[model samples]
Target: MNNSLLIKYGLAGVGLDIVSSADICKHVFHTKASTKRMHTKNDNNNTEYSAVQSEPWSCTERCFPKLICCTYIHKTIANAFHPFIFIPGDGGSQVEAKINKTNSVHYICAKTSTDFFNIWLNLELLVPVVIDCWIDNIKLRYDNVTRRTSNTEGVETRIPGFGSTEPVEWLDPSHASTGAYFTDIGRLLYFTDIVNALVKLGHVRNQTLKGAPFDFRKAPNENQDYFVKLKQLVEETYESNGKTSVILLAHSMGGPMSQYFLNLQKQNWKDKYIKCLVTLSGAWGGSVKAVKVFAIGDDLGSYMLNGKVMKLEQITNPSLAWLMPSRNYWKMDEVLVQTDTKNYTLSNIEDYFMDVEYPNGWEMYQDTLPHSLNLTAPGVEVHCIYGTNVSTVEQVFYKAGSFYENPTLINGDGDGTVNRRSLEGCKTWSSKQKQKVYDLALPKVDHMGILKNVNVLEYISNLVNGL
Candidate 1:
């Protein structure tokens, strides 16, 4: 980052106030500030190939899973917004990103580390040594990590659709007509104890959420095979009935993933089957969780011990293995640098994105991802479902997975993640749809609860039947 770039970005205006669970290597650098990279001499060339640092005892990276996972999801989902522009937020930290449920016009904004160039530039080659190091830290994924793990894995239990060496026979008789259950998201298959319990809900007013079958092993990148699989599923299902009748029920990250699929369809480049698309707690718009993560590193144990993570205890129960803790954009030595706090030890949590703001038109919807799909594909029964239950998470995080900000934006309704206005477009969208965003609100459901809530399911089922 050059001085001119720094001046242009105005990164110093923001504050770094939050948690961190960066990798052990990062933590060593943070706590000791004296740890050096440890590289071994190449046996053949007898030359030091590179620097591989030896980290001491730091456990932040080894444990914080949800933060890292969600971080990747944020990037994967944010990628869906690249076809449009994202405007910068009030703080200039995040360029608001949004997703349009109709036409699927996505808006995205990306700005790299604001502090690295200031401190890590080598000064001679005009090259960013520190930024390069930070890049090396996170660039691991785009460069080799994604490639390295495409086939090899050591997962404890593989979900149904995704690759898994271990056999999971939950569904004795697979729904040949409907296709496999969504075991990829939730380890439990549809035939297993969970989905059955949930289906029982439709019969006896029972409440059972078997969890998502789509396991986000790595947030499905637009170019990944998973995207192709999703597209294929949409096509097969839509054409299965010989037409688009079934609804696409997606939650959280799935919402954006599905949106990306539809966006591809809009370009006349996608060949996925589909019909109605429903988003539940869909992070069509970015989540406040990302903002909070960047502000605070994921030191959950520390936060839990200190009682700070309790702030989110309600919104995101037990911040699983998707949260990455590299959200801070500090200003150092005139360059803007973004470094993943990493685990307290030297472990690298997954979700690591660089600090380069790809001018891929990612600045239009600063807070919203892409919000044009509804207008693009008006034929699709585009419905937005949100949970209205407020938890300690939303009470502090501003927006968990619900929309609760800018009351003037939508009318003051939120699904713990999305606020009322954030659901669709401005006033015009509302006049056309009325309270269709909520249809009917579930008083006390949390973010995930919307997917499992009986009321929400009924609402979805009814909507599907109408379609």
Candidate 2:
């Protein structure tokens, strides 16, 4: 697409240059030498304490070379506050890809590697022709025998700043393309508002506050390494904070991933290390939107973009399969996808995949479905905060001979992305676990909007303060 077309599509003033992820990382993770000390009164205790603002803490060079895993921390006299770890949702983390493919899908695609560059949130790569290259590099390949997914051959991908908030806060650190132009249309700032709110509350980044941004392409089953790292981060954060329990703040797919992680641990481990679980717009049960994304492409709510172009890459992601409307939440008889010949429900999702001509989706679904099917409680205090009163996709209708073509979407109540049933699926945990489950329904808040919603932020602040 041309500059004019991009401008018309809400990607105003298209910049032709590609910014390297290394440059953005350096700029975002750079540390300053300035330090200042100020006295402040604690609101809760009415006691005066010295607060020192210094350079952010980072992992040792031995652990993460050439990468700044820094977290902003404010040194205070009292260190009794609860530390937090943020887990990001789908497409919420920045992914870097180094091209070394033996074969090329198109001449325009990158096949040789100079260095790693940001593939996700790199607007320059998402342009019409270049996106083909991106699709190839970002797509995953599933192994039927191993029942797992791997990156495209010769394409090495990694999540930058695994233990820091920088990757999840602003996807594009340069803030040039999508951040500068498409903010009104799509999400550029992921967990920025929440991080800022926590900072304001004197929760230090990387010290008292940290982020766990995993490779969102694969489901939890395929992300054992990430979960292991997450466990260490939580434990380390807890130990660093005087053995204080860590609070897990998760969003969307992160919620389910966190739940799975919690389920894997012993009750004693959870009781000793975890404070509570707070999920914002949690897909406690998966969303119906995934089914539609499988059938027809999702423009990510941007009408100007062609969703069909990215369909193949999206379908290859096992995480998308994991996000399909959960059998635990959706009734067997409830129709999720409608066709001229038949309607599909939770019981016949495999047929829906076969009809869509991507039978591999069934294998992926089977591999991931077990992770969330039980919906077991995390055995800790839970706070499920999600949006409501927004029209969400409930069912999709495909006309005769139009399975891959445009389909009609039937809307139902949700957060404009997840259905009400999925959002409320956390309610099931209330009765299953001994720990308290708190539910907060914010009206008129959309999925991404919940991250920056004033009410939601205020609620989080209060919750953190009270804790």
Candidate 3:
């Protein structure tokens, strides 16, 4: 192989060069096994070898020309995504496997037929009626306190969990669907762009772009069946690619779920299965906004489509309750953000939701979260990326004790939904374990926007390539 290779050596004579064993290993194990974390200390006690290195492949010229150019690039590009798994944010994945009006349970209820008719009329007919009313020069009075006017013209309709305005044409082949709008576009919107970007960088193969979809409506541990499926996917990917450790990229609530799943595994699973975790706007401590939703159900969102108003009403979800700021994490002085002059903690507001009727008792559900310690896997290296620009309400209040009363909102810097303090929870480690935590704060980016942020994507690509 060496004799056939072109050589440019000083003309002392035709000389032979020997390639080191490490060089061969570097090319052969272009997978993460070569980049596995290793630590060594010098006499000066300067510890070395971080979890992430410069790049997984170092193109050195110590080998044959054919081996250097063809073999390395081909193997590295083909096996890139075998070591990566993407975890999506809340409502990031398609929740409904199949939608049948006859078999599906009704999520809405009314006291009387007349009430139902009126509700449907208001929701379905009001938008076009209002538009017509405006065009016909009819004066309509709506109290801003109770009701407000909305005009949706030239605005693209948005589906829940889907970031695109375009209609969905494709659906996941694994699941059959009956709903007209139930398409795979919602699921694709979550991580497909990031996956595609990685694919362009030659760090992710199209076929290996796998999604670990779960019921975000339920708590992480509560959905053991889905976690089992996630585990299977991880194992399959690992075994398929020569036991390469996987790099988990999770966003929003997916981050906590990934943490819970990782915590369930044996301590040594990190060494064998996981390379490191990269979280984007992770709800580590939970969000104060969720508390407001429970205390006073929100309007959710509304849209006008086909001369109809589609309004989504807020409802209590157990998984959302799970995302509520935990006591341990909320009470941390470093992360306890202040709104106006008063400092708000989960303890100060737990009473508001205590009396609120949840599907199950609030106390029973409260028992699910850790009481003393924050929910995080031990010894796993976590790199946190979050947005901090919009003014997030740190606490909600009313003139009286009820949400119906004149309400007031206090705001601070955050990702519009989650505060910077909460997103940075992973960085609040003890001094001994501080080395395991890393973080980056992006300004003026919202929670949902972080998924599409170029900087965030670039950072993730670097992490994947470096790992």
Candidate ranking (lDDT, best to worst): 2, 3, 1
- List per-candidate RMSD values in Å: 27.4, 12.8, 15.3
lDDT of 3 at 353: 45
Candidate 1 per-residue lDDT, tens place, 247-286, comes to 4555555555556556555533232233355665554433
Predicted candidate 2 versus true structure: per-residue lDDT over 1-467, tens digit per residue: 11222222222121212212232234333432343434455653432324334454355522444433322111221234788899999888889989887888888776888999888878787788888888889999988998888888898998999778888887876655453344322358888888877765655566777889999989988899998999999998887776789899999989999999999899999999999999988987889899988887777665445788878789999999999987777889899888788989988888989988998999999998888686788899999999999999898988897877789999999999888889998888889999999999998998888999999889888987687
Better of 1 and 3 by TM-score: 3
lDDT of 2: 0.78
State the lDDT of candidate 3 residue by residue for 1-467, as single tens digits: 01112111111112212222234344343422223334566453644332333234345533336555556544443344435677766556543211112221122311122111111112222354343322211111222333221112211111222222111112232333323231212323456557656644533241244556555545653567777777877777777555567777788888888878887788776667777788889888788777666655443232223211111122224566676766655664332323333433555444444444443325424544662145444457788889887888676755433434434667877887876677877776534353387889999988867777899888877775565
Query: Residue 306 in model 1: shift from native, Å?
Result: 9.9
lDDT of 1 at 187: 20
Candidate 2 C-alpha error for residue 422, in Å: 0.6
Best candidate according to TM-score: 2
Clashes of 2: 1
